[model samples]
Target: MDNQKPSSGGTFKKFIIALVAIVILALGITGVVYYLRWFGPNVTDKQEYLYIHSEAGFNDVYQTIREQGIVKDTTTFLWAAHNMNYVGRVKPGKYRLKEGMSNRKLINMLASGAQEPVDLKFRGLRLKTQFAGYISKQIEPDSVAIISLLDSAKFVEQYGFTTENVYTMFMPNTYQMYWNTTSEQFFKRMYKEYENFWTPARKQLAAAINLTPIQVSILASVVDAEALHDDEMPTIAGLYLNRLKRGIKMEADPTVIFATGDFTIKRVLNKYLSTPSPYNTYRNTGLPPGPIMMPSVNAVKAVLNYKQHNYIYMCAKEDFSGYHNFATNVAEHMANAHRFQQALNERGIKK
Candidate 1:
């Protein structure tokens, strides 16, 4: 009877051990299945995919990824990413995803920080327009917020520009930038691009012309506004340079129009001349402190490599086809200006 009792106790202990082993084996298999679903060969199937926006944070990223049917279980995906230290590694940008991506592969891709390039166009933009466009495309910040920030004197004072013209800082070009890039970073990158274009040789040429780089750009902006044809730029630049050397007031109509901030070309009445604005070349001489608009590289180059000439004044030819009449003296300029007025009358443009 004693032997039978001992045998029964041993059988009970063995049964308990077997049950625990079975439970552990079952759990191991389940864990393997879960792991394989997310990070195994099953991930290559094209039917299961996700598109992730680069700007999404970890939680948002996981949610978007799951919504696209890339991951069957959010908890498992989050767990895997966390365990692999990929939470901080995920790049902000558009990313193609597949199901069954291995934790290692996903983490590696995130760590690589791949970004989608967004084209930022700065062509023919005024400062306000450029700021609005940049904020809309890159950071999605409020236009008012950006304008207010740009308007702050303390913020823009470091650039060494006399005028608070933010538009002048940017060069008109299509730049590749990340979508979620900060405004400060965007400006920094643009400044870097500007520096790249303004090489030492260009700087020497600007110095030879007795103008700072910013001043050159400012003059270029004026030249850009005045000249309609590329071939006419050198002559226009030469004429302006001559006037500057002679300390003559640059009575440019464009300056008067810009000062008025009105697109209409109605007569530059005496009242318009009194308009208080820094852009008024007629009122405030010497490059108007800063650029009125972002000038193209060609315009800047034209100013730097201006042709030498004694031409002091120029007037748009009556044809308004962008050709100008160059004059070496005030009398000659007045005659050309009369011809321009006649042309304007013929076209019924009362300017």
Candidate 2:
């Protein structure tokens, strides 16, 4: 029953202790909240990939991230991004979205421009427009953008190619590139690959054949179109080389097909041959202004190492085995052509 009043200093010390405890508790709660917001799993389970387009601003990125519903929480991500100074550092690219990604990791990845590389592959493309369309699907630039660069004489000229011969610069192969590659960058990359492909040996082989690299591509395109089987590429190449040597027109059916712009033609009629296009090897001598299609590597090689042969005429084998019947004389070629025509007539492949 003895109660003594405490001193003012003791009461002040008690208040101070309580204040310190409250401050510590508040700090701990704040730290925990921030940790959960910034370091906790943010990505949803539904998305496996996220694509950010070129020149995307922070608002655009946030809109996409939220609209995709991959990020489990958006407000927290925005806060984290702001604190990390990532608001202005949005990098456009393709990114893999994981099932469980933290805001910090995602923000860091985007801010640092860590984009996935796309595997761009093209082969046997018929036209420059076709090439542009194929490339548009693999990267950031659209078909129109690619076509603009492909059609630009000035732009392609810097790469030592006219617009007509620019098709040769793009070799058929798989190339690894950033998804956000510009059209100009894509062309430069292709040009570099083209240079790499045409080594000193390949150049010497082209020289030996009295053909420029582009001319080789042109001839290879014809060879590729002529032979359905790879085994016969060298033979077809040799036949064309023989024709060139003899000053005879190539009279290639594929060139007629190219001239008519009718890929569905199973048989090239006399009318088709007289289409009067520059690509018509029947009417024009030497290589066409450009390749009719993107020639394969094997086709180009076939032209470089053409088979030695005296046969200058070839017709598709009547057996339909994708083999050709070779002839050293016009009479024999006519017989072969007659047999092939009979076979085609039996198959009902008119026109």
Candidate 3:
């Protein structure tokens, strides 16, 4: 009976040891799993940004993460993502990935749809298509999609703009926006900006000048295209306004270049003057149908406060300086034109 008690006690001790060992092993495994799920650094130092597309699922996101070489362990990230319910909730945006970010932080940010906004700056765009192209480079919508909206007369008319003058609605400036902004959203945002730009004070100025807002924009575009120097814009605007007041043809060379669809024509030739388009200010009696190019805010303001001058004509200086020689009579303008023509001939810039 004593030997039987001893054997039973030994067996109980062995069972206790086995139970303790199993508990320790389980705790070790749980610690490792916990570290991987929430604490371990998943992002690598080499990674800078992560772009999650709108249609991306778990596999697509995983592939992108792997391709960027940011995650430390793909399997651990997958496990954490699956557990955190971040597998199917992929958000589309430009994400700034920081080094040493844990799976928990990364997954939480992505799941919450916290994406960085893109700074979109558009300047010097001449056509609506060009504006669309510029916007498409920064946003989710493609060029074709944006162009569809820009060209749709029915859609643009809702914003009180025609297909021809629709380009004026998008003022050129930097905007902070999300990357997934739709084309319609972008247009509305720009229209809002356009409205904000034409404040009551600006509207009063336009009324005082006897020009509508769009007309002011058109004239500003002409002035912008004509003057290479910003300081000379007011003078150029004054000359055009004088012509407008006298009921004379604006006879702007940029309009002819726009009509000809040839931006490379540095020297406006007589052949370009005969173009039959309404945009040909030499042939047309007043302003063109719309702006030839996107005008700057300074250019628009210059038109609002034009310089008061009696000079009725202008010709490019013969010295190749981007300055113009102003004239009150046809004889003086002819002299300036002859000098410029001679300079162009000397430089072999015919046609």
Top-scoring candidate (TM-score): 2
For model 3, how does the per-residue alpha-carbon lDDT over 180-237 read when each residue is reduced to its tens digit?
8888898889999999999999999989889989899999999999998899999999
RMSD of 3: 3.2
Tell how far residue 16 is off in model 2, in angstroms. 12
TM-score per model over all chains: 0.72, 0.91, 0.90
Q: Which candidate is the best by lDDT?
A: 2
Candidate 3 C-alpha error for residue 322, in Å? 1.6
List the candidate numbers ranked by lDDT, top first. 2, 3, 1
As a TM-score, model 2 comes out at 0.91
lDDT of 2: 0.92
Where does model 3 exceed 4 Å of error? 1-26, 45-47, 67-70
In candidate 1, what are the lDDT values of residues 1-351, reduced to their tens digit?
Answer: 545445788999999999999999999999988766456642345442233454667778777666655555556657778877778766665444555567556656655765446676766554565556556655434566566656767656765443355556677888887665666676578678878888999999999989988888888888888888988898888888988888887777777887787867656766788778878988876778667767888899899989898998888888778899999887998999899888778888765
Error of 3 at 6 (Å): 12
Which has the higher lDDT value, candidate number 1 or candidate number 2? 2
The model with the greater TM-score, 1 or 3, is 3
> Count of backbone clashes for each model?
4, 0, 0
Candidate 1: which pairs clash?
Answer: 43-99, 43-100, 54-92, 54-93
- The ten-residue window of minimal lDDT in model 2 covers 46-55
